[model samples]
Target: MIKKITIVAGISVVLLATACKTKDLKMNAAQKETVSNKKEVVYQVFTRLFGNKNTSNKPWGTFEENGVGKFNDFTDTALQEIKDLGVTYIWYTGVPHHALIRDYTAIGISNDDPDVVKGRAGSPYAVKDYYNVNPDLAVNPANRLQEFEALIARTHQAGLKVIIDIVPNHIARKYEGKNNPKNVTDFGANDDVTVEYKRDNNFYYIPNKHFEVPDTEKALNGEENPLIDGKFEEYPAKWTGNGSRLAKPDRNDWYETVKVNYGIRPDGSKDFPELPAGFDTKSYKEHFDFWKGKDVPDSWKKFKDIALYWTDKGVDGFRYDMAEMVPYEFWSYMNSAIKVKNPNAFLLAEVYNPNEYRNYIRLGKMDYLYDKVETYDKLKDVIRGKSLPDGLSDIQNGMADIEHHMLHFLDNHDEQRLASPEFAGTPEKGKPLMVVSTTISTSPTMIYFGQEVGEAGNENAGFGTHSRTSIFDYVGVPNHQRWMNGGKFDGGQLSQSEKDLRDFYKRLLNFSLKSAALMGKYQEIQTVNRHETQGYDSGIYAFLRWSDTEKLLVVTNFSWLTTSNFEIKIPSYIMQKWNLKDGNYTLTDQLYHKSAIQLQVLNGVGKAHITIAPSESFIYQL
Candidate 1:
């Protein structure tokens, strides 16, 4: 059996490489070609809370407060709020239609189906249409396109970019049209009679069977004449649904979504009517003419035009939903098209495990993705004081591998909050642990709206009056009126504890945004084990980040008690390069405005010993 091996390194050596081999390894040669590209800060907003007039109406209400209305109103206050928070880009979630049927249950207006709706707004992942906005979400139903354009312009005016969600994997079942069955196309058949569907045309199609590996291989391999049995076959084939490719209802069970067909019509074919009912084959032909010889299906080709249209409309970028489900070719094509219209457009893929698929970076597929393994696995272990094989070295390496951008967060909408003890010990310990993890990680960070405010219920927050995990407090509403009247008022009313955490977050965000060393590429300066200090070897880790112009050292003690008489060896290169004559350096506290650098050298080895409190984190700058 072949085994996979990974190499992890300590911080001190990593920094030494940066200092000595600065020019040799600035960025990969290909990445160096694009180093002039500017980095952006993306602030993800739950659109309903930010400004959805149909949802609520208070001070932070939906475009109207006490009957006063303004044009392009929803974004006016919300943009100002985010701009104050120092975010450069705004990522709006769920701007498109939620469901095609308009059933109240789909949007949480009714709570009949727990699987489909649980008194919470449906997951925006279930897209109704690629081309239309949700009517309920729009300020003006008839002028949605104009209103959306105005929203994009307003965001740009605020010196912020905009990125809307794009769900390419599946379209809502109802949106395919009422006449269409869940599996069969509107023509009462599972497949359309495109050239790919005709046996004589050399395209592969599966009979009766749902998507499977054999069918997919046949389509991709361009088999002349492929046949398959239920048992293992000598040759396999790829699958391509004629015109019914996009009409497939069940995304979870389908393999075609993993590798969509990219077939072109043959030689000036006109008036091909063997398409699924309600689908205009002529329109598809006209559209396919734009791409000419592109091998991908007509449905997949539409994405390029859609992306370009939005880019030209001033939408900055896209966060591809379930990006891995789509092919890399699609991402490359869409990214190129988006960049053509807006060069600075930021594309972040919702990839859960990026480390396993790091090659996607070179394809220009995504600028950033959610780093789940590091945040959930490694960070979780550290806070719990478990014996990690390489201690915090794994985190240091993970930070280094993030080539373009990596979003650092302790919790997100899809997962349980880090505040939950099931993952990070206890809320009391988890809060500080999260603060340290989110702040110190060498990636652009993201804080879910309610995280800083300590909204604890991890259960789904209802859309109506009985929400357990309400974001009303974060949106600045009184708890009494927020729950009773269902988020009616919003003049920045917050509980004392919520207010304290919010203030801390504001300070932290401002500090982080202002620091180039934190956002820029990092070079680890040092790492220390616990034996060097009195009772320090238990559960503590220290490291540093330095650029040519700036240097920062971070020390964290993940214990529940005061660490007494701990000594750490300072790297000789750092000591000599910084020119510390007395074997000591100035310590500037990043969290609290405090400064202290006094230390005694042991036998001229340039080692310093200090005491740290429980759950304490310190940052020293040189």
Candidate 2:
């Protein structure tokens, strides 16, 4: 469900790039404006793996063989520590009930057959029940929901908001809601199974077809075939999660789950109300009122109810998976209802169609969308030594108008790690990337739990591959395990290198939260330096962020092997904006306040010479 968005003609188009090179970023002149607001930071932790300490590394091992983290693992002390790192929100991944292979049937939850599941632990996306939490995350197993509720209260008490996943695009192959609210019906419960498409039906049906599993020979399996018993029963094969029409899909297809129908007919015409042409500029309140008295399709009400249900339960927000796969109208309906309930609720989506960015944000009422296709992908190319440092200005300039709505991140559950062999193989490279992403704009920044400690994610789990940590199979994150220090949540066992990395993250993030200029205005000085300043390498970058009370110059070193020392020239126009005089002034690095750079200004122009280490970053306050 990872997508790349490119803005063209004020419309978001799906920009597919096999390599790191993406389309040049662009935005309407009217949309490009400097932002000023409090910076937000989101910390995403895969709930099942965050506190797991098992070191056996056995493939397809039992839950005991590879331990799982409990909701209680996020103790008051741990929450404070994470809050101390400057996080405003915590996205608890894999919280909903999914089809895991573990036998919870004895406790009213059913087991999933390995023949249809991806891993021994199954997938967090293969949701079995929408109203319940994952039982594996609770010590009592039966009290999972209570544990999660308590975690939410604790997180709020720590001054951090909570966000969880709402995979509206699909559900598990064995969808059932044993604990659905009274008067609520199960999916496909009141549907006419004979029809292929129905406005009220929860799923699309292949009336006469029977379900056939993927070929066992091609699928990733355990040491022994866990499906030897051979009975996975499902009548009338439904569409696969990726919209695969085949009764039997390939192993590479998303065969573990089925796609949820959202009133679109087989011919691609929608059965729902379409937003008016100028609705893209409408507010959520307008969108909400438009649907208040209208009778919508059944699937629309179903999802809207699910979202409002969670909102009533005090869940602050949701990170929607594969948002564009579902129709834009559906999001407009569901998200508007959510806003009506909790206007401050955070709604982030994975909408990759760059053309649809505005539609989703305005019409669909999404608060933020992933900026991976531009900022993140560009950063990756620079880190890998494949792209020039003509730099991210164009990308930022392109996205400046909507920069605040573009969520930036170096690593998440779906991407490769910073230190993975397949990506950049050093943690230090993230230092410069983080500085630019956090300081350049008002966009929120997110970091996976072990990213700071440099978790390589090189384990051979059953269904998941290396380069990205296993979300399907239970396993330990070695580097993070060191930082965990066996539930003490202390860095007592961390190596010197890991300790240094964590400290760098702490200082930079804390500064981002506390800085006034970062949220005020942004001006790129990198290109100016490369053209005017002597000894300015193409690999070096610089920018300016300021407010009436504070002005700061930022420099980043992206060189893989070279240490950079250069005379960075501040242009006359920039000097005039800051009202500089012809004199000498001391500019000190925010990260290392005592370290100083002397600036010489003559006739409203300034120049400073400083040496920066490889992969280092500095925020010099003027």
Candidate 3:
């Protein structure tokens, strides 16, 4: 693949020098936590959209109408400022060269038919070239790869790691790996297309079937796609990315890409070697050496070499997309090989099946998986004021065995925004939600670029809709643009309320980064309180986190219309477990330092008379 690593120099820093967002950020009142391991925090930014300056939010606009963020936007000074936000890693989304509707034929890059593309800028997950960076993200499209490498170098210099996406389950239908290594071959170069399935073929094919365009295509209805003649010529049609075998896939399906084969037969039987009976109990080292000399399928070797190639270029890790759809065996082979190259690499995947959680984490050698089904979904219920915290404690208690392997987040590119009407209508609703997400576990926490500033994803970007931020179209984000502040990286245009909300997130995230109690131990005191007394209600939740160096009391009110003032009782069992004696101590709210409560250890049971406002949360450091 095209591997060009360059370090850019002499970028103008006039805008950065004027930005003063981090000048007065001094979080005090909480004791500085010193521990062996601290919690990790992630800042996920859509690379193509983070630095955009255009305000023309016209739906279905062309490139000239809506501007895209360039790599130069993330200058050395900007990265240093971002590092000051207490983030350990930055996930740069939409980094790869994907199949966009734009034409770069002058640079020897072929034009993509608009009939199959998602939007004017296209979907980043539909990768067109695995080796090259997206042309839209570079000032000079011909040197896009160099621009990305410079970004990686700058991030490392700022004391932050970088992560990119790796979509293995599928690729753009018109796949081409530019500047591939001499030893490497392009996907489907010599595949046996006549057969429905083969042990070594890269993709599945249908015998003697010609691929037809979906009837819902705008071009099919005469809206015009210059290169599309309402047909895609394939003697034996390949299966759609979502596993649809029809000659004409439904418009709603993943019709822009084709599925990659990994030795699975048409009947869903594995053609590769499976791990032994007790292999789940084996370590990643053993798993790595197991595939050292074994002959593997072509697809497996291709993906493994692809991952190692990027790591060798200085990328820290990958955020695998739709990992569950790919074979579990392929992950075991791929992830083990990845860890061998860099043992400290952070590998995360999006796996939704609770039943396969253990298998993916243990045998697949994945580091973290999205806790959407159990943690995020159940929390949304509480936000809607529907159910009592039925599964909140269970999610923490049930997954106690593997809680560290889960990543927590309230806003992401694929989910609805906190301020969206379809989701939570107000930014205040996210205040308590962020506390529960960050402090309830020892896992990593992530926030989207505009989440703290309350960017409601209600834009009319083409081909992307509803609640979440648009990944396909080039549209300006109103709220995030205020924080961008004319490329100053300062909240110059934000209202006082917005600034206060951001301050709350800053304290919550910064405290999470340094707290030993957060990463040490967790106990849901709400469960015991539910059975012991009437003070704690369904709208309130309480928990305790402690270690040898720190003791933390956390409580949040989920209701937006009610204020909860009650005495939270720590049961005798917890008192004995924490080695409490009859004494009085002070507990200060780390979030705002607005109140200090009288913590009593009398009668060998701890009690704290606390008052929480609507959508307010506290992390008291004792």
Candidate 4:
């Protein structure tokens, strides 16, 4: 038998050094408390595509042709390898039973029309059943739920938590809940479809109008299917998921789904009760009490029940899709109920509006929200030379109150790959961004599965042909497949650059996971350095993170082509905080440990003359 090469094999030395240094630091009571609060590192893998070994990625291919991965594919060894990468939660995306075009009539699943589905596999957001797992991911379609339960159990055994999606904004256009429990009924089952909006109704209806599919040729995307007839039967058309009121929604709209009415009328008026003043500062238990005996919307109760059901089934958390589109009041009721069930549940939301960040965190009780518009967009511009790195300081400082509630990521299922030609043109450019984002604040770090292996999701997989990995089709990720290595969970086929990239992630994530300073005080030093240092310009970003015991000087060079030699200084206030006098202190890089650099302190100021390679970053430990 051939030896399996784990992701930890190359970076074991660096991790060991980090562990030893952590013990050597003289931590105070507060710093020790901060060290105990370990930072979360989320590893998001599209469950359907994670274990598929098939490389025959035919465009618009059926499950049989492309070979869909099953629940059994996440074997113990595969999960252990993921755990070794310093992941705390494995977000098993696309686990819910979504609308797909496959025929499962043998087991009571209705065939969906291609006109109403995004691709042959369909979008994961358009859920058909909330009570069951996707049959496509099970060896036996009838026992799909059992297979997923086993996966949840196996994940717990591997010392990791699990997170799944709960899209509150919509449901599939053709929802068939054959697996719903006896106590639970299908959405819109008791709806009065004659009315446009009702407090008790599950969906908003367009009375006296019939549902019409989009243009057949455009919906099919040049794919041949027997069910593409440009028709779907409905007595009254419902509002599209994106709030489109048209009987036939446009091709760009969320046409595969219908919006779930949360006591909001069509005239931009809310029918739900607004949370009272000072409720934002209340605890989840208190918020849970506030909704007691209140006549809440029917959709709110149904989604809350769905969330509790999953909590009972060992699901550790949820990732709410398009959270901003839904009302914050509904989130208060729903998330409060979830917290009452599992206080430790990881509740993450995708709220992009900068103004609503505090409302979602405080009012909605969300544990984390996507830091996309500010941190992610600004960092992308910095890498492309369109924006300066100093701009990040303002964004971080602006959200300092809720910085820990913001989750950072370079690539996700919705975003373009870092290695794609349209993005950075190479994964090497992500090094500086990764270091800065990971160590910037107390926020949690998220990494999509193939990001470590440098996967450029540029494949033309039918309906999804952008630089992003297709969540709407059956396709294989080429770079991820190399690391899969025939289910050995090893990097046997990874190139040298891929191996190096993966090693860098392993070191940085592991260090971030245990470092006390990451969860401590932060001060951006980029502006001060630009004015004081000769070579330090907008192309360079610098910051300081410290606790009672440990201090970290983080610097990254975003310039893609040239080496930057700059003189970095620790300010007088920070020197006073550390109580340093005129002497030389050794600063070691946490990621590479290339060499020990010297920081000289004179007149209550510390300075280090540094030369950094293009796209290189260092987390210097003092």
Could you give candidate 4's per-residue lDDT for residues 1-622 as a string of tens digits?
Answer: 2222111000011111111122222223322221125589999999999988888888877787887888998999999989999899999999999998788889988888888888888899999999998999999999999999999999999999999999999999988777777777789999999999898899999999998887644554766667776788877999999999999888788989999999888888999899999877778888889999999888898899889999999999999999998999999899889888887888999999999988887888888899999999988877765667787899988887778888999999999997787766788877777877888888889999999989989788888867999998888988988999999988988999898889888988988888877777778888788898887755677887776667777777776666667678879887877777788877776667776678888999988878776655555665
Model 3 regions more than 4 Å off: 1-37, 217-223
Question: Whose TM-score is higher: candidate 1's or candidate 3's?
Answer: 3
Question: How does model 4 score by TM-score?
Answer: 0.94
Reference-based lDDT, each prediction: 0.46, 0.78, 0.78, 0.82
Model 4: residues with Cα > 4 Å off, grouped in runs? 1-36, 216-221
TM-score for each model: 0.68, 0.92, 0.92, 0.94
Q: Which ten residues in a row have the lowest lDDT in candidate 1?
A: 8-17
RMSD of each: 12.2, 6.9, 9.8, 6.4
- Judging by lDDT, tell me the better candidate of 3 and 4: 4
Model 2: runs farther than 4 Å from truth?
1-36, 216-231
Q: Per-residue lDDT for 313-423 in model 3, tens only?
A: 899989999999988878889988887778778888999999998788777878789998988887776677655654588888888766777899889999999778776
What pairs collide in candidate 2? 11-355, 12-354, 12-355, 12-356, 13-354, 13-355, 31-401
- 291 in model 3: Cα distance from truth in Å? 0.3
Please give, for residues 437-520, the per-residue lDDT of candidate 1 as tens digits.
Answer: 544544556665455555454332223122223322122212222221222323255666555555555555665666544544
Model 2, 50-84: lDDT tens digits are 88888887887789888888999998888998998
The numbered model that scores best in TM-score is 4
